[model samples]
Target: MDYQSIKNILFKFEPETAHHIAATAFELASFMPPVLNALQKRYLVTSPLLEQDIFGKKFANPLGIAAGFDKNATMTKTLHALGFGYVEVGTVTPKPQTGNPLPRLFRYPRYEALQNAMGFNNDGAEIIKKRLERIYPADFPIGVNIGKNKTTPQAKALEDYRFLIENFKDLADYLVVNISSPNTPNLRDLQNEQFIKDLFIMAKDITSTPILLKIAPDMSPEQAVNLTATAVEAGADGIIATNTSIDYSLLKGAKDFGGISGKVIKDKSFAIFKEIAKELFGKTVLVSVGGIESAEEAYRRIKAGANLLQIYTAFIYGGPKLIADINKGLIEALQKDGYEHISQAVGADIR
Candidate 1:
């Protein structure tokens, strides 16, 4: 049956429960090579036109599954099979976290959005590191998105990130420093210039693995540009334009807590990303996330200076077909625009 039919049944359960059910399917598929290969054959879209090398890795396509969907490393193989160019796992912490109280994940199907207050819940770095050791060095790229523990004081947040970076640097093709998640108390406060400088400096000292900074979309274009510029100047290899947004009004009947993502935040995210891109596009690798739902949006991000693109909520709503559809649509769009390769379109608008 189709994903929408499946989603209709899945939607009957609470969002978190439905997510676990779906995640379990991917986890199980990892052990079955036949299932994986089959999924890849049907969903995976690869073309020389879409292929680009970033951070010394070959991304078969620019589209990737953003960090939160595969918070643990279990789904990497399956996600790749489902046509994601890369899979970013974890918002892992120094310690295992239960996250916020239950009922923390909610879905707004009409808006194609989700609000999650899940605060860095994961199996912790030690466990996740072991998981990656067994699974890393795959044909595709894998990124580990790390964050500070909830109980860790803001004063000690640097140490938490330092520990996570040290543990994951060798395991992941790249690493993402996730200080901008809105669920963690005082996490966004760490987005300051001095702290970003110190964090990237410490990361550079540890491993040469390309580390990128993930920021929130709640800031002004000016703040976004300044903060990202600071990150790149301080040795960050790339920047993921945004995490999720805390702007509740974007979706009517929104929760006062957690962060909102998907269709509702598209314009907000694109505006901030465009501003950041105008200033820092060529200075570092640029990744655009938040509310990317189609080929047109993906192309817009590329032209606006995104070297890579990621999707989470859209995947939930649009299902697996969306992945291949986007890659195919991107190819068509690029050819129609008189571009031979995806790289040629990167920052076309900015140039």
Candidate 2:
């Protein structure tokens, strides 16, 4: 079936149910080698020039599926088949929780953006770790994004993070400390200099997996610069430039405030990426994530100093072919700009 047709069928159900069905279907498909192979043959792009090494891991391409798409690591194998060089799974917490009330995920079809307040919902780290151990492939790079549970107090945040690190250290290619998702109350408070430094120390002592700090797009330029500098000093391997925006200006007519994602925040995401890139300046790996929908936008972020790029909202809107399309366009863009590989394009446009 075609992408749009599949999407329409999925959309016919409630949004969250559609997501669960999609993940299950993909998981089932992954078990069939022939089916998986055919899907990859049709969508995956290959290029020696596009291969990239970030924080000691090599990726076939710089494009990855951002976190929040596959929250439990249930379908990494299937996602990798669809063309993402890497698939980041989970915003998994230390304990299982139901998350916020339903209708948390809202669609704004007219604006091509989504507003979600999922509140770090997941199957929890231990369950995810066991499941990952059963399904993880040696060939693909999959990162685990860990979050504090809704019931966890801010004072004990590091304990929550430490629990996951101690348990899932070997299961993930890298570790993302997600302290920026607005859905969780006071979660972003961890972004403060002293708190982030302390958390990194705990992470460093337990796991050698490259640790990446995921920050919010709502931060001020000075705040981003300070946070990046602190993270680097504290031994962080990289920074995922954003989670989702809490700003509602993009949703001028919308009734509620949920995390805003898609084209509406692309420029803001890039600008934040550019500033963070300039501040860190070859010192840390930067993974840009908000509002990327096309190759041109991906190219812009890479040139602005993002070592790797991630997409969620765009993949939802563009369907399965998005990754291959972006990688193909990235190859052309690299050639046009006299770059040999994605790394050469990093910070090329930054002043």
Candidate 3:
């Protein structure tokens, strides 16, 4: 049956349960290379126009499955088969901790949104590092997003990130330092300049892997730009323009806790992204993620100076066909704009 029909049934379960069910299916799929190849043949789009080198690695397309989906690095090949150009796994802590309490993942189907207080639940850095070692040299790029353990004190947070970076720096094509998730206590507090400078400087001293900072949407556009500027200056290789947003006003009856993502946060996410792009687009790599749900929106982000785009909530809502449709639509949009390559279209609006 179609994905929507499958989703209808899955939606009946709690959102977290549905996610586990999906992950289980992917685990099964991993045992069958033929099944994966067949899926890739259908879903994976390829064209020179969409290809580019970022972080010194070739990304077959600009779109990736965002970090939260594959927290332990198990779903890379499965996600690639589903047509993601890349997969970023984790929010992995120095040590594994059961994330916030249950009932943590909630869905708002009508709004194509999700509110999650999942708090970086994942197999810790060592386990995830082992997984990456087994899967590296795969066809697509991989990124590992690292966070501090819940019990790790804020003062020791740098130590957590340090350990994670040292572990996965060689395994991942890129590393993301996640200090923006609202679910982790005091994580957002690290968004300040001094912490960012220290973190990136320490990270650079440890590994040469391109490290990006994932910021939150709650900060003002100016604040976002200033903080990211600090990160870039401090040797961060890129910026992932948002994680989930803590602004509950975006959704009616939204739980006041956790962060909100998907369609509801699109405009707010873009506004911050656009402002950041306006200042730093050419200076540093900018990766945009938040509430993107269509080829049109993806193209809009590209024109606004995103070197890469990521989706999690929309991928849940749209499924495999959505990935193919986006790559196809991007080609059409690029041809219509008289751009020979996606790079030409990358900052068309700003240029």
- Model 1 poorest 10 in a row by lDDT: 164-173
Q: What is the lDDT of candidate 1?
A: 0.93
- TM-score for each candidate, following the candidate numbering: 0.99, 0.97, 0.99
Tens-digit lDDT string for candidate 2 (139-204): 768898999999988898889988988887888888899999989989888889998899888888
Leading candidate by lDDT: 1
Q: Candidate 3: where is the Cα deviation over 4 Å?
A: none
Candidate 1: deviation at residue 248, Å?
A: 0.9
Cα deviation at 277, candidate 2, in Å, is 0.5
Model 3 poorest ten-residue lDDT run: 131-140
| Candidate 2 residue pairs in backbone clash | none
- Per-residue lDDT over 1-351 for candidate 1, one digit per residue giving the tens place of the 0 to 100 score: 888899999999999999999999999999899999999999999999999999899999999999988888989999999999999998889999989999999999888899999998898888888889999899999999999999999999999988998888888889999988999999999999999999999989998999999999999999999999999999999999788999898999998999999999999999999999999978899999999999999999999999999999999999889999999999999999999999999999989
lDDT of 3 by residue, 204-260 (tens): 899889999999999899899999999999999999978998889999879989999
- Candidate lDDT values, in order: 0.93, 0.86, 0.92
Question: Where does candidate 1 stray beyond 4 Å?
Answer: none
